[model samples]
Target: MTKTVQLLQEQFRHLRMTEVANELPVLLRNAEKMSWTYQEILQEILTYELKRREEKNVEKRLKWARFPYYKTLNEFNIEEQAALSTRQLNQLRELNWLDQQYNIILLGPPGAGKTFLAIGLGIDAIQRGYKVVFSTMGELVQLLKTEEYIQKSKVQLKRLREADLVIIDDLMYMAMDQREANLFFYLINHLYEQSSIIITSNKGPEQWVELMGDQGITTAILDRLLHRVEVIQLNENDSWRLKHRSTIFN
Candidate 1:
């Protein structure tokens, strides 16, 4: 490499512009061949580096989100779930609801795509530069319980509060003790009106009363959640997992 090029690479590295450092040589050659103006060449380089950095940031946020699987709205079968309005779903992709701190409750039977929709929306939020965290109800409760003793729970809770959206999947898949319930409620209380939440549950609000096993506390929890919420019920008859179960054995 030329001394000038090497120095430029070092400067780019110092600035953490790995993309520019790596692509500068090829881009320079192209600019030379195309007889581009100095201003045009500079704009091209800056645009490419900025796009690369944005993509990397999105990837990092998605990694931190911990989605169960990578799914997008394009992969979802909107036709199969006719109950969901196409226009509304498209609007959701715009992510304006996050600004409104609206909670989305997806209720349906098992394998009805509740989790899939939640993960898809979480991915969308990450792509739009919104911080997101995805965890199963049990997993989050376990984290809170384990960290509660060491006072790490408060630190962890503070971190979660920074997210624009928090996705809780498969809630009420298992019953919780009084302590667990309290921990869960604490999280809800903290995030309430401060951040948006997307939850997938096999049980509906009425059924949650029994699952929680404490009507009074459950009522308090539900009150905050439902105060500004969009309830989407996906009542497909067949389970997508079951339909695709043969793929694993095959």
Candidate 2:
């Protein structure tokens, strides 16, 4: 065992356990018996430390403060949902999109991976060091209902407009009433040119009017969102849900 390894392992031992100091000599012998070079051993320790720091950072980001929670991409956990083709994923990679100011609409039936894909994209953006806000339509409306503003409702509007990537999950789940529809329009208009938006909805563009129950508001929202966005229509698979394999965590 090298003197440096002995010293470092002893230090780690003292920090971990009192009797750990005695185990360091044996630990170093095993590490040496593996024929690891000094550089390789140092790199292994560094890698472990780096991974610890990364896990902490991921935890912080998952907290509600660093990234405000409307919903969680991690909660969606659609690791087996094969919605996109390899060609499309390659195109998305080549484009490096999600950074650009473009709207993305995922239109499909329930359990068709719309919300899963949208949350996946949001997770991707967060890992890539971009700010993101994810909220469902019902949750967003409830927020608006509770927040009372005397002058103008600018704070929420500003957050929506300034976010690097905003995700609105379950877009047309409930038909927005008069006031909610107006507020929704205000948000869509504000985010039109400034930032990117991703929306997951069961209703397609053609069925939006019926879902919203207002022709004017539906047209206004769709005109802005669809103008610069690409609509991905997910095919309805009858047995896809049953056949999908989900991993159970310990």
Candidate 3:
């Protein structure tokens, strides 16, 4: 029986069924003790392996998303934000908007949970089997400004194109020069209808005109983005960071 098990392990490795190969022996013993039939044992083993594979895929997708930190809708305390509508929050959670390539723009004061919501939705999208990428406005511009400008930009842009969702956090946090504005326009243009974007900004659309400093570029970027967008304004009374600041001491 030992030799037979060893041979089966070698065959399982060749078949790339590592999870089953490792866990089957213990499960088989449990099955015997439980008086499980052959078909029942086989079903349980397959179910276990399939579940592990699904979890592994979710982990891989989350890693590729490049989220600075992890957050979830459960972590968001909706009760505190009286201004936000429960219906709208539920709609966003449904993820149907992403299927239609609609953009989600979150405008609010600093630390009002815009970034948290964006990251949470991104993590949700990954779990639902959609590819996602997260980048800050400054990081994206720096990527475009690298030494191998053309080649590097191409590779980075391709990454965005391949994703089902692209999250741009802190969209108007820093001043944007003409070059940065132009680069941003180009990126937005490519992703226009091809993929969904989630933008978290401290400034609203009206404020972006002065933020970009170029009307043409600003208009162009907004035109494509706002065409099929859901504008969410998070108007909580106080910053979540400030409210939760004392929790660490507790």
Number of backbone collisions per candidate? 0, 0, 0
The CA lDDT of each predicted structure is: 0.85, 0.67, 0.86
Where does candidate 2 have its weakest 10-residue lDDT segment?
64-73
Sorted by TM-score (best first), the order is 1, 3, 2
What is the per-residue lDDT of model 2 for residues 1-250, given as tens digits with 9 covering 90 to 100?
6788678767876665333344456545656899888887666555655565666555554442233333444444334445667567455433356656778888777777676666666666666656667777887787676557622334553555667778888877788788888877887788787778888887788888876778989899888987888788776663334455586855
Ranking by lDDT: 3, 1, 2
Best by lDDT: 3
TM for candidate 2 is 0.64
Measured with C-alpha atoms, the lDDT of residue 169 in candidate 2 is 86
- Model 1, 1-250: lDDT tens digits are 6889889988988998889999988988899899999899989889989999999999888877878789898887776676687887898788888899999999888988888888888888888889998888887887888884656556555557788999988887788888888877887999999999998898888888766778987998999999999999885586766755666453
Candidate maximizing TM-score: 1
Alpha-carbon runs more than 4 Å astray in model 2: 1-58, 65-83, 93-95, 149-161, 245-250
**Higher lDDT: candidate 1 or 2?**
1
Model 2 whole-model lDDT (C-alpha atoms): 0.67
